[model samples]
Target chain A: MKFHWFAEVTYGHTTAEEVKNNHTWVDAPATMHDPLKVGKTYQMFIRLMQLADRSNFDGLAVNEHHQTSFAMSPSPNLIAASVAGTTENAAILIIGDSLALYNPPTRIAEEMAYLDCLSEGRVIAGFVYGTPMDSTFCYGVPPVELRDRFREARELILKAWESPEPFAFNGKYNKLRYVNLWPRPVQKPRPPIWVPGSGSVETWDLVIDEDYCYGHLSFSGLRSAKPVVDGFWDYVDQRGGDTNPNRMAFTQICCVAETDEQAEKDYAEAVNYFYSRQNVNPAFAQPPGYRTVKSIAHDIEMRGASSLSNEDRMRAARGEMSFWEYDEKGYIIAGTPERVRQRIRELATDLRIGQLIPTLHMGNLSEELAAKNTQLFGTEVIPYLRDLWADQPDHWTPAVSQQRVNANMPQVAGVAGN
Target chain B: MPLTTQTVDDAQIRVWSAGSGSPLLFLHGFEQHPGDAPFLQRLAQSHSVYAPELPGYGESTGFESIHDIFDMAMRFRRLVEHLGTGPVDVIGHCLGGMIAGEFAATSPHLVRKLVLVDAWGLWIDADQPADPFVLNPEQLKQAKWHDVAAAERETSIAQSHPDGANAAMLLRQQNLGVATKFMWPIADRGLSRRLPYVSTPTLIVHGESDGLIPSAYADEFARLLPNAEVARISGAGHLPQVEREDAFITAVETFLAK
Candidate 1:
């Protein structure tokens, strides 16, 4: 199994009252956050990611969100550039660039290629149709045209990377006079493509048809993810597509310490802060045409008459759950390395997930505690889980980072080295 | 009054038509067609009314063919031509107002008189409009009506369809999705540039209490059109026809008579 380091760069210092009073996305008050603190936070993430590299993580993932204090990463490429320049062995995974937001899309083609070159071919390109709030509400791209724009941008970027000569291109959403990339990606054709979706069948078909990795990136943990993830695998299996675990990625918040008690003590408040601070105005959450009627129907069916009620979801988001309740619900995997390893193993095996993007730091987590959590998880939890899906080859992450992580990973005491 | 489906090229459109005299085309707001609401019925009393659900809204089809506002204008033009009524009086509310404005500007010969009610098409930097899509039920009620209780009594969604509340909710979502084509973002599709070209005598009917759009926009529209007048309906918000039906019909009739 491949492990990636990830976190939602949530602004620290936002109070519970602030979360209650205002939304965290689109129109969230900007004056609530301090600029100097934001800069320091960015530097802190870079420093922590560098630490993650030294501790034998296979990849470091970054993502894009706009006009939100929930995640301060408006431009994930800037952070990816920082990680790529500093980290020697980890794959710089941009989980992704919102394709429709960029004009010409050759800009994305150019930038991804530059990151790939900078990282010496260690980059994974992700194309996303950004959140409704980010794209339709904040960026003002009509929701009806968002998917069309994304498809056009993707086509343009791919052609730009592959075309040897300057070619004129005409697409419905984008028209380009010269379609050639100056610094083409080091990886032949392109870097490994990973498309993260919240269980849209169209996205599934695209990933399966193109043989790209598909990531179910959500903080909702196992119970909330199981139905959709199972639905995804069922769709893939029924279509006669590859069922290799390596092609699937899932996100889970990880809280680790020397003991289970210490884990809760260190992470309880931060985890609460992480979940509670994400206050999305209901109107901005789902704009018209953002999800097709078919997709919406499918989601309602897959969500099925289940135990996870709407009230549970609301309560969890409100930070009303106890830390142990949070862990029990699979929102967070909190405990000692031994317990965390056991839970993650079950989670990975149950969901058949090969790539785990474990969010180690969250809102208001002290830099010291985050470093320790990263260290413990890197040294203890990851080494034991390496045997999982080891039989299945992973083409999702760059081979260079995989090899480096494999070489540096401490050998399990009882298990034989590959 | 009867609801009929007409096929134009590859697309099918659902149109509500009634009465006979001068031809009048009624374009609905961002929501679904008001159906056989009292306001539409009242207008049909004096004039032949043709109210087609915009393409892609509800059962109407051919939304995929529309590329931009120009294509939308052409669709309406074809719909009017298909009606076989020579130039008609056009009344557009909210999103329909924007489309009606476009149609009048592009097909000057087809529109005899234009009425834009709480319409959207212009963007003023100093006085930006509130985003209709983002408002909650309470917030939307506040923005759309002078009296929330009266507006609730006038809501057409619950009474228009045979299906239950869930289906009504779904229909509302579908209608708004179609509205996003022209009204999403700022709702300004360069109509300010085209308004000057409209040759039809125009009436800008505004709900005085409309929280969705400010009264200043009526002046802006009047300033741009070649011949236009502004009429503010008292005790109304976004939907003047629903809130102050008698006053709205009188203003529209007076303008069409001219």
Candidate 2:
């Protein structure tokens, strides 16, 4: 299985008390953020990602959120641009640009192409209908029109990337007299596409029908994700889509150290900070018409099977979980590298996920420890997991990244003294 | 009156209509269409009240087919013409009030008189209306009524939707989703520009305690129309007709009579 270095890039300066006072993390007050601290945080993430690239990680995943201290990245492209020039390996995974948020979404095609060229053809284009808070509340997109806008944007971006000559395109949401990308992507047709969804069947159908990679992204860990992740595989099988595990990616929080006790000691406070700091207002979480009635019904049916209760989720969010309980709940895999690797192996196998995006640096983690975490996971955990999905081919990531990561794996192992 | 379906311009619309006298076309609010409410039943006693759920709302099929507020007004005109009643008196409340203003402005010959109650569509950035979309269920209840308990008395024909179990949820979303087209980012659709063209005698019935649109909008509506009067009903929020039916009826009927 491929291991990607991923983290929410949470603003580490805010405390749990401050978060509670701010009310909602997504629409938290502007005055709460110290611009200097935010700047340093961005720098820290970039430095950590660069280390991961040198340590043989396959991808550097960055995501987008708006008006939040939780994840300061409003645009993933800026972060991707930073690492693309500095890093020699790792696919610049923009997981991704919110399609509906961009006007005349050829802007996305242009930027992604620029990144691809900068990185020598290593870019994974992740198309997303952004969160209700990001798209509807922050950007003022009508929830009902969001999907339609995303669909139009996706079609436009794809067309702009592929079309050799300038073309006229008239769509419901966007109209372009000149449809041309100045720097087309280095990949022949386009970069590999990854679409992350939170149990929306429409999104599943979209990825499956187009044969793009499907990412079931959640912070709920194994227990919360089991129902949706398992349902996706079952649905893929039922629909006769390729059941190649490489096409499925899952995000997990991984805390690894020399020993199990050391891992807990290092990550406990940060783990609490990571889980507790983000409290989205219920209204912002669910805007009217964001999810279809059909999708809600599907959720009602699918979510009923999961053993994780709402109380468990609340306790987890409140940072009330003991370090061991968080591990038992699968919110984080905390232990020695051996233990983490074993747990992840079981997780990937059970979920049929070939791409594992392990969040290394969580909330309030020191830069030193984060770098250490990145190095350890990149060396110890990633090399061990390659044998798991060795038979299956991964078409989801850029080939340049794959080649670079594989070639550097032995060197990374040597650094680990293995 | 019973709920039924009507078609205009090949678009299916759910309609709630009753009573018989002078033809009175009632346009319900931005939310759900009021079913057999006391105000509607009272108005029906004196006039033939016809309330059609706006396109893209509950059981309404023309939402996709209609684009922009002008298109919506044109649909209203077509529906009125289809009714075979000439120059009916129009009463529009909240989001409906905004649409009624547009309909009266664009189709003056089709409308005899106009009534706008706690209307949206006029945007005063300085005194912007409370965001109806952002308000949660409890907040919405507080914003929409003088007494929270009155919400129980508020009626909707959509409650008996054909889609079983999740009908209330489905219809609420369907109706509000339609509202988001014109009222998403802001409630205004430039109806203020058209209100100046409406020469029809008008009444602006406002709930005194309307937190959603605020009473200032009622004054703005009155200020713009050629001949319009304002009636601020006491002990009511956004839905004056539901909260103060007698006062609402008296204000509207007096204006139409004049």
Candidate 3:
């Protein structure tokens, strides 16, 4: 399976005081963590890209979130552009711009198409309706209106990218007299798309129906996600759909060292810092619609259905339910080579996860620690996992390109299959 | 629309031709084919824009043919007739624009609208025009001769470096060398006398800051074409499309829309 490292590029220590101390620094929300300056972030991202390449990683991933301490990537497109210029042959994946946040979707289509040309067609477009809280309040998108807007934008972007020149599109979110993207991507029919979520009912349903890859960003852990994944499989089965385990991918906090004790000692503080920051901000911890009765009901049912321990629920309440908990039962996979490998293997087999995307830079972990984890994982865990999947033809492959995924576009618009 | 590629002797010619509108046959300058100009992409959204690959560009073949502007004009006339479309709107840029003016003079009936941009073949009085490709010490200082301050001037042309030499190569390789060689050249009779003879609407687009061809040439070119209207694009040098694309597009759109 393909492995990628995700980072929020959080400025571990830039506080409200720093902005207040300097008039030129500009005004910022006291509760938010802004991204590092363009030049520094660009330089840091380039270094990460080189490390990703050295690790035999298939892709370098970046994403978008705004007005919060959780993620500093407000313009993922800008980050994608930086990555595009630095890498010659790696997949530059932007989990993408929030479609609901953009107006015409043509802007997304045009920018994505331009990026594809710049990278010679090494772009994977990720379409998402961002978390209701972050997108709605920060971006001013009404939560009730976001889903339909997202669907319209996604359809409009797809048509604009794939259709012949001088085409006209009159979708709800966008209308154009004529449509054509200059310097079209090298690949025909455009690039692949990955939808990001934690097994949200709509997302899983669409993943199965469309056959697109689903990146279950289960930051909380395997126990919280087991029911969701199980629900996805059960839904597919109930719908009489073809079973494809390779469609699912999970992202979790992972760190590795020579020994479990050493790894925990090295990582615990940073992991604790990451959670502490979330606790202090609380905005990241309590997303809008997250505390609603309906949402709480779903979480409770999912937790009970998965048979998770009460400790996990209380931890979830304390905003520490993530796998990084020291109980060895959390979603986090940390420790010695053998210990971490065993945890990953358990999830890979029992959970049937096709790929494991690691967020090694959580809580602004030291660059040295992040790089060390990457090197160790690349040199150690990957080899072991490959061996386990060697004889299994049904296992998913790690490398993917957008051109390959965009080939099967929805030919008939507005028709739901499956 | 019909796309046909045929052998014009040893050279392969590619043409996108169709319909019974004003037959506008367009030719782009060096390193540029029909696609580089979105003028056609946008115009095609409306009128019948017939863009062909000028030899050695796009899909057209011929590393060496049409030695000068005169030769290119002759070959273009045959293309207009071969495509079986009528009274043409013959448009060209740089050396190609000079050839279109010559084509209008020689085969007056073939063209209905003659448009030229930063065209060559007209020599303005020793005004030290901007040669975006060459600085030659004197031109470098002269580039700063504008009314703007020296600091702002340096910032203005900072990105214009690296491309100065490439532009000079276009002059030496295509236009200058061939113009010096042929006696029956592209700029034969200045076409100034033929202005009244040619019954066609004309538009002469000149770059305001064109160093290769002075803005004065637009007036000269417009005065030479009887039915011509003149428009100047601001902040534009030799390649107006690159510097002021929106303005260049709007000018062309306004003229064509009329």
DockQ of every predicted complex: 0.64, 0.58, 0.01
lDDT (10s digit) by residue, model 3, range A1-418: 4566566666566543443343211124554433345346456656876676556555667888775555667778888887777665556777867898886678888888878888777777788777644565466553334566787888877777787766887765567888776656555676777787754576666766776667777566677678877777787789776455556667777879898777877787667555544422222233222222233445556767876677765565344643345436655789887777778887777777765777777665777888888778766766556533334343122133422322321232221110
10 residues in a row with least lDDT, candidate 1 chain A: A409-418
Question: CA lDDT, every prediction?
Answer: 0.89, 0.88, 0.62
TM-score of chain A of each: 0.98, 0.97, 0.82
* Clash pairs (backbone) in predicted model 3: A2-A398, A191-A402, A192-A402, A323-A330, A323-A331, A323-A332, B130-B211, B133-B164
Give the distance in Å from residue B24's predicted Cα in candidate 1 to where it truly belongs: 1.7
Task: Assess the local accuracy of residue B147 in candidate 1 as a C-alpha lDDT between 0 and 100.
Answer: 87
The sequence of per-residue lDDT tens digits that candidate 2 reaches over residues A229-250 is: 8899889999999999999989
lDDT of 3 by residue, B66-86 (tens): 544456667777777776777
Between prediction 1 and prediction 3, the one with superior lDDT is 1
Docking class of 1: medium
Count clashing pairs, candidate 2.
Answer: 0
Docking class of 2: medium
Show the colliding residue pairs in model 1: none
For model 2, the interface Cα RMSD in angstroms equals: 1.5
Which of the predicted structures, 2 or 3, would earn the higher TM-score when compared with the native? 2
Off by over 4 Å in 3: A14-42, A279-300, A309-324, A387-418, B1-258
